[model samples]
Target: MITYRLLHPEILAGLAAAGHGAQVLIADALYPHSTGVPAPAARVHLNLRPGLVAARDVLEVVADTVHIEAAVYMADADGGESEPVREYRGLLGSHRHGGDQEVAWSGLERTDFYAACRRPDVCMLVATGETRPYANLLLRIGVP
Candidate 1:
């Protein structure tokens, strides 16, 4: 009898367990979830098919549940900017906050992003079947 938009049990559990400053990774299909980030933090695979559940879709849901302090996007590994980053920035601009909260977007090097995800503070990872390059995003939860 949940009234919220997000109904996934695992996602809800992870969010509940997570504290402020904890990170949640919403990754693309190409992102290496197995070795890049360790398990036991909880992972929800919404990647039903290619382009089935996009990273943006999951981002929207996660945003609704948590107050995002900052967002990190992967820069092109080939030493250039990524289109996905542009789209992600646009989405962040349109994201609505109920109270006096703000969501900021930040860019990180591809390697740096991978390294950050390895931190022990990351609570969960959602692997979506998005095929777009550099579609991965890391969100830091803010206190309400």
Candidate 2:
């Protein structure tokens, strides 16, 4: 048996195929998984029901498994920090992104967020059952 908490076969396979600089999105229930992202990207649906599986939970496991270089969250419409964004910021607090060692984090505008996630660099999108608004998050994989 695998010792890692990330036991999902599809998740393992998708992450294995992706390399450094490849993006992974832990999307909330409201985020568009199909049309918002590229057609070739791997999709994992953990959204069995509302609040059953949080985007934060997925993010935690993914962070443990991969070296994250960057983090981007969909900004709240009111220009205030949402619950998930706060949690994400705290969780990804220490990661030094890219070759420059900069804190690779951004709160993206609504339309811009969708566009960034749609790029071919995204390898997988994990659709969670989180109910909170503006909880979608994007991450860039770093080198081992």
Candidate 3:
């Protein structure tokens, strides 16, 4: 009965179970889904093949499903953002929160980013087949 594109039952159930400040990761093809997140977290694989079910695709649908307060992505050493980051920025621009009322677009070092993924707060980890490098994204769930 939902109008949104996210129709998967498992994904909907996982999102419904998580609370405010919880995180959801949209992992790329190279991401270590099996070993990265904790066993308690839900790992939903949408990675059918390379270039299919991209991280951005999951992000767009999940955005419609929940209120995202902040989003984080891996940044390069030189401080330049990737195309995927730019694409995600466009998607997050409308949803703002906190005092500044702006969606936090944070950048983390590669190793640190993976470390963040393993946290217990990561309630849902969507494994995508995005082929681009650094296409991973971490979304912080916000209060409704």
For candidate 3, lDDT tens digit of each residue in 93-134?
A: 876654346677899888999999999899989999998888
What's the true lDDT of residue 16 in model 2?
91
Considering only N, C-alpha and C atoms within 3 Å, which residue pairs clash in candidate 2? none
lDDT per model, in order?
0.83, 0.87, 0.87
The C-alpha local distance difference test score for the whole of candidate 3 amounts to: 0.87
Q: Candidate 2 lDDT (Cα, whole model)?
A: 0.87
Ten residues in sequence with the least summed lDDT for candidate 2: 94-103
TM-score of each: 0.89, 0.92, 0.92
**Model 2 lDDT tens row, 38-134:** 9999999999999969988888888878888888888899866688999988877755445456447888888999999999999999999999999
Global Cα RMSD, each model: 2.0, 2.0, 1.8
Model 1 CA deviation exceeding 4 Å by range: 78-81, 94-101
Q: In angstroms, give how far residue 47 of model 1 lies from its true place.
A: 1.0
RMSD of 2: 2.0
